[model samples]
Target chain A: MLKIIQRWFIRYSEQDRKLDKAVTGITGRRPYNIRLYRLAMKHSSVAAETVKGFKESNERLEYLGDAVLGAIVAEYLFKRYPFKDEGFLTEIRSRIVNRESLNKLAVKIGLSQLVEFEGRKRSNLSHKSIYGDAMEAFIGAVYLDKGFHFTRRFIIRKLLMQHYDIEAVIETTTNFKSLVIEWAQKLNHKVEFNISETRGSKHNKQFKVDLSVDGEVVATGNGFSKKKAEQDAARKACEALDIP
Target chain B: MLKIIQRWFIRYSEQDRKLDKAVTGITGRRPYNIRLYRLAMKHSSVAAETVKGFKESNERLEYLGDAVLGAIVAEYLFKRYPFKDEGFLTEIRSRIVNRESLNKLAVKIGLSQLVEFEGRKRSNLSHKSIYGDAMEAFIGAVYLDKGFHFTRRFIIRKLLMQHYDIEAVIETTTNFKSLVIEWAQKLNHKVEFNISETRGSKHNKQFKVDLSVDGEVVATGNGFSKKKAEQDAARKACEALDIP
Candidate 1:
């Protein structure tokens, strides 16, 4: 039919083909609607105004993607860790989908290169979550174009299977300080991290942190920065108390 | 086939028939997996120990259901308000799914009756989100048994369409205090609520609240309780500033 030929012509247009090729590299499938992928890459910083005065950006898509990602990850973790408690599942899910992790994942998957933004206005952007936000928006685009089951498959196969090492992700101690603080709060115990000592020159300084619980110094740690020292102390404290 | 007859026989068994009838009233469909529905109704307070010594309760289901519910609601709101910003979408979604709202929704849908818990140990349960938690677990059960699309249809048709008046939900001023506080924090403005006055006798006392922004009193409201008075003042402030 004429409509079919017209659709094929539009899909195979020079610009559309270029976009399709780029998107296919990341998603492992040819886009059903290249426009959605384009919109996914269009950051709010360089958003265009529609005829109705609405800014066409990836923010709405990001919101949708965030929810989809959360659900898929929750189900995945639930099935994988059948015997694990809900608290452990929640903790691990957070670790995987946190902004820092998403940002890194986006870069790892070559998604960061596709995101379009006003480079000059980068400094005005308060949060360093643009790449992660775009990754989420891309997911939203996939969901809209291909539906939930297909999107879930893409996320599991393309992203999780190809990129993430689950065991290593679980073992990462990046958030030990917050974890220890949360554990203390649950037990109704007061936790304090104090910088007990400083050593070496200004540029090459080592900070020692003492982690106290209920006025008792339970653990000590040393590192190049105060935050690092605190986290190290918290990790030690977690080990001593069997917090995990 | 013998297998098909066996499946049908099990589905219509006496006890299953009763559960199917009760659950059909809520979800408008006979459960594909009756055991999941049973688990969904089982509260942690009355959880049975599995052969592996794990407590069998609705907590895991609640976690899964929470994510699924969030995704479905996010998508619904996204499509319903195409022109609305992400912040507006987020606010409305939270208003719809927050603990208080979900608790009320659960009771409204008659899901509270299906929940099994220890009545004597109710005080020890602490959080009053049992009904809401069971509602979420029920959703997880539906998701696992019937899959995402069927669950989405049930939520939209049985829950949102039948029970919720979206306009009234949007107009509800229950969370005005938290909304105004959030607004103030975003703008880096100092907000304070002061008890301006207390009047009348003990049984019929009226509390007056003055809501201030950046050291200036913006609104005043009176109610029977201090919390109510603060909410009233916050609502007035929101109206004065054209917040919504």
Candidate 2:
């Protein structure tokens, strides 16, 4: 068929073949459309402008991929923890898909090697999430190249099962401050962390934070730094409120 | 053949038939599993507890459906607006899926008729989103019963095409206060609305609100109530900052 020949011609280039091999090394399958994977690797730092004036980058794909990933993960957790409440499922899902976790996952999966970005711009603090963003965009590429069922299989089999240990992911302690803030948002409660006390010397300082919800002091925690103290207080407050 | 007979027997009951008809009316297809639809209609206010100590309600389904609906909508918008940026797509998607909009959509789709809740508890302000919650649960039910491709078609053809005008949905104004708050959350900016002044008589008073983002006053607005004034100020601030 003419269509089959055209497809073969598209994949005949040496550059396309190299991209195909790299993507296959990562995803365990050859990309049907090498163009999607190419775009997925393209970071906004070195985006190409199309003739229509649209800067071609991975952002749009990232947005779509984020949603697909969320849905797949939601269903996965829902089935895995049938007895757990929605809050528990939400908390665990967030732990798995948080920016930091995704960044680590991307690196572990060999995505960092394939991602294309300006070398000079890599040192900027904002580029820390570049790999994670690219990972999501790569997911978008998979979803588009295949379909939802195939994409779901790829995520669960290739990504989650191969890379992540679910039990360890559940046991890992995350930022309690963010947890409590999210809980407060859901319940429409205002949360504030106040530095109640400072003790010890300046070089070896200890900070105490009082965590309040709805103007009521719920818990207090002490740590070596303000951020740590706030996180500690938040953890205690979460326990007191039975957030999860 | 035995499985087909079992399915027929399951749908033979009068109550099952009514529910099947109702669900068919909304989704344009008979559910493969009517039990999921039944659970979808079960509101938490009148939840039934199983022997395993699990409460049978729509909450978990709502969570899953929320993710599925988000993914579907994201893809729909992505393909529809290939030239639009992610921010614009996010804003429009939020406009379509926000609580108030979903509540209205639920009512318009006649989902309110199928949702079951304690009538006495319905008067509570928190029950305002019950219909929307049920709509999402129904989506989850459909996804479970029919799978993703069928559900996507049902949403695009039945829910979106039949009930909503995309142009009108886009043009409809939403709560700017929530929009600004969401934008601030993304950018790690603190937003505050300060009542700058009160004028006119007590019975017919006017409130002036100054909206500030990250400690800088960006805009001010006047209205009959503090909430209204804050919304007005937030709207102006959104325009000033070019947020979507």
The per-prediction i-RMS, to one decimal, reads 1.5, 1.4
In TM-score terms, candidate 2 sits at 0.73
The segments of candidate 1 whose C-alpha lies over 4 angstroms from its true place after superposition are A1-15, A51-53, A120-127, A173-244, B1-16, B51-53, B120-127, B173-244
lDDT of 1 by residue, B139-220 (tens): 9999998899999999888887887888888757577998998899898999999999999999988999999999999999
Tens-place lDDT digits, model 1, residues A1-244: 4433443655456766777888888878777777888888889989988844479999999999999999999999999998877877897898889899899898898878778888734554545599999999999998987889989999999888888898888767568998999999999999999999999999989999999999999999878899878978997899899998
- lDDT for residue B213 in candidate 2, whole number 0-100: 85
**Residue range with the least summed lDDT across 10 consecutive positions in model 1 chain A:** A2-11
Candidate 2 chain A, poorest ten consecutive residues by summed lDDT: A2-11
Best by TM-score: 2
Docking class of 2: medium
